[model samples]
Structures are given as C-alpha cells and as structure tokens.
Target: MSAGQSSGRYEAVIVGAGFGGIGAAIQLKRMGYENFVVLDREDDLGGTWHVNHYPGLAVDVPTTTYSYFFEPNPNWSRLFSTGTEIKQYAAHVADKYDVRRHMRFNTSVEGAQWDEDAKLWRVALAGGETITTRYLITATGFLSQPHTPDIPGIGDFAGRIIHTADWDDDYDPTGRRIAVIGTGATAVQLIPELAKTAAELTVYQRTPIWVVPKIDFRISERVKRLFRRVPLTQRLVRLITDALYEFFVYVGLHHRQLVYRRLNIAASDLAKIHRFLSVRDPELRRKLTPDYDFGCKRPTFSNDYYRVFTKPHVHLQTSGIEHIEADAIVANDGTRTPIDTLVLATGFDLWEANFPAIEVIGRNGRNLGKWWRDTRFQAYQGMTIPEFPNYLSLASPFAFLGLNFFNTMEYQMRHMDRLFGELKRRGATTFEVTEEANKRYRDRMSELGARSVWAVGNCAGSRSYYFDPTGEATLLRPMSTRAALKEASRFPLTDYQFS
Candidate 1:
C-alpha cells in the first residue's frame, strides 16, 4: 500500500470488518487466500458495535440469536447482550479465528474499477494507496452509516449537540434538560437511559413506533459453565432461536393475516402494559399508539421503554418539531420547550451506504451511480449488481426481515462464498451478473412485495423507510426462508460470464 503503485495482484480484497466482513475473511483465509486485506474506515473491528456507544445500547434480539452461528458463544452473561458485550464478542471472534491480522485499520475503499483484460479489481483507498485484486468483497453493512437529521439552528446552538451514532461522553446529561429527536430504535433504548440522568427529558416524534417488551434476563453462572462444558448446547439454543425468529419471514410468505394479528396484539398489549407502566397522561398514550401495522418499519423491543414515559421528568411531544431554535425545539403546534442539548436518534443513511457521494467508473467507463440509478439500485436477489463484476452488496433489500439481519447476512455470505469458489475453480476473475437474471430477480421481488406487510402496513398515509417512493416494496423478502435457499441455490453462476 505504498503510493499509487498497485502491487498489481491479490486473491481478494474485502471492505469493512464487521460481522459480514469478518465472516468473509474467515472463509477466505480458510480457503487459503493469504494475499488479501480487510479494509475498514475505523481503526478497529466490530463495525456497528465499535461505533455506537450510546447509553443503554444493546441488542433487542436474544444473545443466542444475535451472535454468529459459525462460532457460537457459550458464556453470555445476559440473554440480551449490551453494546460493550457485543463489541467484545466481535473482538473475540476476530482474535480466536485469527482474522484480525488481515485487517487494514483506518482505511476506506474509495472506489473500484474492473480491469476487463486483466480480470482484476483496481481498488483505490482513502489516501493514495491503491490495491489490485482479482476479486473484491464488500461487507460495509447497510445500517452502518448514521444519517443525522438536518435541524435548524444546529450551528447556532451553544450547548453540545449529539448524534446517537457519535455519542459525546464528556458532555454529561445529569441534572440537565435533554431533547431527543427521532423515536426510532436508537431513541427508544436511549430515552430510558437518559431519563435516569436528565432532570427533564423531551422526546420528539414524527411517527411513534409500535414496540413490544424487550424481555431480558441474566444467564446464570451454572448455565454458562454448562454451555462451556457442552458446546453443542449453545448451538442447539442458537438453532432454536434462529428457527423461531425465522418464522417471522415464514408468516410473511405464507400466513399473512395471522402474523398481522399477532403484531396487532403485541401493539395492543403495549397500551395495557403502559396503563400500569407509563405516565398516566391520556394525550401521551394517544401519541405513542401507532396507527400503522407493526411491521411497517423496524419494530423495537424493550421492557423498560413504555415505563420510561412514566418518569416524572419525561415528556412526549406528538405535534412534531417545527424547527430548532437556539437552545430549544419549536413544535409545529407552536409549543416551544427550552433544552440545553439535542440528541438525534434518527436512523442511518441505509440506502446510500455504498459511495453515494463518490463517482464509480466501471469498465467501458460505465458510471456505477448512473447504472444503479437507471436500474433503481435493485440487485439480483439483493446480492449482486449488474455491470459491477466481482462486486456484491452485503445489502439485504427485500431480504431484510427486520427480525434477524444476521440470518440474511449469513445467507448472502454463503452465496458470495460460492461465487468466489466458482471463480477459483474456473480460474476466471472478471464477472458480472446477466441482465436477464437481474430483471427476473427484480420482477419476482415486486410480486413478493405486493403481498408483504411492507405493502399492507397501514401507516396513516405515512411512509416508512422500508418502502421506496415508487410504492414498490424495497425491503422484506417475499418468499419463505426455504424458498430463499432454493433461489440462492439456483445461482449456478453460469449466468455470470467470467471475462
């Protein structure tokens, strides 16, 4: 990686060292590809876990379900592991599996060019380093980029402004008025934690989410010992959780009404729980209740969330913020509340994670942005983009069930691994998905999207980030898990021409 001179050869180059990237690195290293690098912008492992250190940050899914299946952890202290615990888990996986040494920390892949004749990927790094590899694998996760909401008076604010992705530990919230904007997953967990410290807390809402209780409990020391002793037990537990959560996709594929009913019941149960858990304010309850179906956006889970509204210092603002004035949030209803600090819990810039700003020129000087834009950034089974040979998205479009992202990540990785194996067997490097296959794949997705909850989720005329503007569903796979496997297996990859 010295200057502009590319070593002009590598078996593969991976971008991002998150779970997917680490997983790919493990597979490739085991496959005996030594001349490779796992590039990450951050100077560390644990992609999302390395970045988001907000208060009370933890996985909503059970610990067993959240972890990687290839190497399961037997000694989790809690059922729902905290952010710190999860990050440590990622570190352990990297160290134990011996994948950490292959990583290029504090480095980012600016763009990639496909060398048609040489069948190598010319990848340019953030600085002046350029690495050439026969194959390129991208694991930059879909949710890794934080999209801070554009608020007025942001620069004018004298007090410290914080984003959930970039948490400021130096600015203490203790005995201060804190305003949290965006009631997404990040806000849900953070609000309760903030309440414990802030003298007064105000939660701004554009749309309230339908959240179920996040059931959590500590795993006994004896259980950990047992898991360590009998490693098979941990795998058995993971299999069970994977199956249980996988059913959320199953229902979406087959029995839609029942799943919808269950989602509704869970939402209704929240109100009853709030009766005993939250503040006894009628307007607050009304504001929190979502008119949309449960699965519209990502559903949040937490036992303490509803109870947070009951805190004496907490206030729920449903009128939506009109604008941000200096040291205050102005609501649309003309209500102004003075606050010292503002926290943006708004979700990440998921759609534009892959070089939304940079221009990528492929072979024939085909602009990657123009190609994706013309084709709507749709992929074949949400894996490979046409014209971008040796390029694959760790992106899960229709495949994103919002229940278990890791499950889809594993599936997508398996497909990628197979593709690489084929490349090695044939001694072919340059590759691009056929336009016919991509069109069929996108068409199939549209039909599946038509019947899924993403299409049916009644959102009071509001739209979730899950759906694209065209009204065609962009998230949540249409078929069952079994069907997805079948489709994945159909990728004999002969449709891809190896130049």
Candidate 2:
C-alpha cells in the first residue's frame, strides 16, 4: 500500500457507490466494459441513504419520479417513500444489475491526477494505494459532505451532539431537552419527530423554508399488483409525475420572470395557505413563513412540520445563536436555553466543499477546484471539462435536471453511452471537451440562468444553497428534462476532441 505502488488498473474508475455510480456501472457493462470499479468511503452502497438515517427521513419528491426510469419499483409503500425503502431499492438495483460485485466499500479516494503520457488517471486512495484507470467518472453526490456550523464553543459542548447526516441510531430523545439548529429540508423532516419525544424542544432558525402539504398516502396492494402486472402503468404514472415536475421547475423556478411570475406567486400562496391551515398561531406562522420567492431555495413537503411548533413544549427561537456553552445555547439577544442534546440539521456545503469532493489535477497541472474558484464554475453540458480529458463529473454544474435526481442520472447515462460510443467508433483512448464547446455551453447556461429565480428573483434574503460563492446558480441546468435527454444523445460529437 505504498504511495508509489498501484493497487490495480481498470478501464474506468467510478468514485462513488450511490445511484449515480450504480447507473454508471450498469451503462459501462452494457457497453461491454467490465474492467471498471466503483469506490465509496462508506461501508455500504447507498450514499446519502447510508449516511443519513434520521427520523422522519423520506423523499420530498414522489416515489413515481424519484426512481430510475429503467428500473421502477412497483412496491413503494407510499407516494413519498421512506429513506429505508429507497436504500433497499438501491441495493436491489445494484444486485439485479450485477454492479455490486464491481463496488469496493470503505474505499476513500483522496485525489486523482491525469497522466498525460500514459493517457490515464492515477487516483490516490486514503490507504496510500493508487488506482490507474483510462477514464475517471466521479459520481460523488452534491450532498456528500455535511456542514457543521463553526459556532464558538461547539467543541466544549458537554451534551450529546448529533448531525442529521451522522445520526446515532442508539440515542433516544425521550425526556431529554433538545435544541435543533437549522430549518432546511432536513430540519423540516426532523423537527416534527423530535417534538414527539423530547421533553422540551427548541429550534434555532437562521432562515425560514417554504413547506407545503405532503400528499403522501400508503399505496394499496392492488395498486402494487397492477404496477407489477403492467409495467406500462407505472411508466404512465412516471410520465404524469415528470410532466408535473417539469412544469413546476419551468414555471415556478426557471422562468419566474421570463414567462410567468404569477405561477411562482401562486406557488408561494399555496405554501402560505398550507402554513395558515397547519399552524393556528399567527406569530408562529409568521416566523415559519419564508420572505423570499418560493423557488429561491429548495422546498420540502410535510404534514406536521408546522404543527410541531404550536405545541407548548416546543419553542422556535428566531434570534441567532451567539455561542454554545457546555449545557446551554446562548442567543444573540443574551437569552440562554439549556438543553441536553444538540442536533445540527444544517445542510451541505455544496459549492464550497463538495463540488469535486476530492482533489483533481487534470491535464497541464490544472487544479479543478482552484480553477473553478478563480474562474466561474463551468462544465461542458455538465459532464466534461475543457482541461479534464477522459473525465466525467456526474455532479458537475448544470448537470442536475428538474427536481428528481433520476432525471439527471438518466440523461448522464445516455451522455456516457453516446460519448463512449463515439470514442469506440473513433478508436480513441482519450476524449476531452473542446475549449470552444465548453465556453459555448457555459455561455448558453449563463444566458438561461439569467431568467431563473436564483438570478432575477428576490433571493438575497433567502440564503439559498442554490447560489454559489460567486453568487451564481451553478447547481441545476436551466433546461427541461426532455431537452436534456435529447441533447445528451444528439449533441455534436465534435464538442470533444478524441485521440
């Protein structure tokens, strides 16, 4: 396991074991490439699902749209499936596709460097092992890294501290005082569960989130049988869900100012109505309401999130935390609240910490993270970068499509198919996006993003994770899912240079 010694070589090295990695492995196998391997830092296959087992964790999107279009699960327990079911689905797909054999769990990749003369990538692992591969596809998800607040005295806290990402399943909250920080999507799901058991619960809110009614219900056995009997029935449901998802993304978020601002307003009005109905206290509802547009940040669905605050034992603290003591959290207004357990529901550091998730030194000594920070974050069609030859970053800017990640994964799988097919047809060993093509695509994305709510709408007060440090919405592509799929297949092959 020396630094200079290579553990092995492969045709491709995928740096994740999540759904993205599983999909990539299946595509590679389908393309007659069996020498690829999938690596993950976690001990299990599911990425987010394996890392997060917090109470009340479930899919915000419907089950119909959240799964792979190719491998539909007919037995989803509910419209919004639980995290456990999603994890099981991941295992099923990996096993059914025979991709699990290619995965190496508890394997952390520290960095990767493209060897120009060798025309391959040298990936460094945490245990001092190197892996050489012709193509490097990083499927490290956007939410891989959790963001713990750098609040003073956090280290000195004597009480049990838990991050939702690193939740301890053994810990119970009964009869214990708890303080939860953050009000994001994860917090929206977790706060209600904590309110049920904790003797006293206090929520530290930095920013309010838009919460709508989650139309979740248990799927009947008859529906499951029908879905299994007729797969096309699920496809039709998927189509309808996808259409609704596209409409929301296009009208409510991407085209807020360009086509219809009223749609976004109507969405906000719906959230307000849901809030008004859920929480009877006007002041609590006011504190829970978001000040920005509906799509400024990602929204979540919950039936009891708003009602949790109305309980007498649950308190909502709007004043930001000053610092944490050993047994208490002090507010900015000099108010202190003592709690036995501290829960950090703060979300991930997307642009700052997790864009690449590992060091990538590409051709000509180009540092991917530093270059992105110096310039703007740009990737050609959100897959290939100009300087990074033989590389595909699945979580790259503009790669995400609509609300469902399956849409992004589906299109990226197609993109890989087309790109690799061209590589095989040309008998080339390496492929890098042309600089002109990358720039053209980046320009087009910027142009489209100018019309998005993140760019033009009132998002300053939102503290949206969608906006990067450069104040740009570099996460999601501003195009429809159909367009993304079409472009993935039909994009000019000349966009990349093969050698």
TM-scores for the candidates: 0.92, 0.98
Pairs of residues clashing in candidate 2: none
- Cα lDDT, all candidates: 0.75, 0.91
- The top-ranked prediction according to TM-score is 2
Report the C-alpha displacement of residue 432, candidate 1, in angstroms.
Answer: 2.1
Stretches of candidate 2 off by over 4 Å are 1-7, 257-259
Q: Which lDDT tens digits does candidate 1 get at residues 218-254?
A: 9999999889999988888887877877675566333
> Which residue pairs show collisions in model 1?
214-302, 214-303, 279-310, 398-476, 398-477
Q: For candidate 2, which ten residues in a row score worst on lDDT? A: 1-10
lDDT measured at residue 371 in model 2 versus the true structure, 0 to 100: 92
Worst 10 residues of 1 by lDDT: 1-10
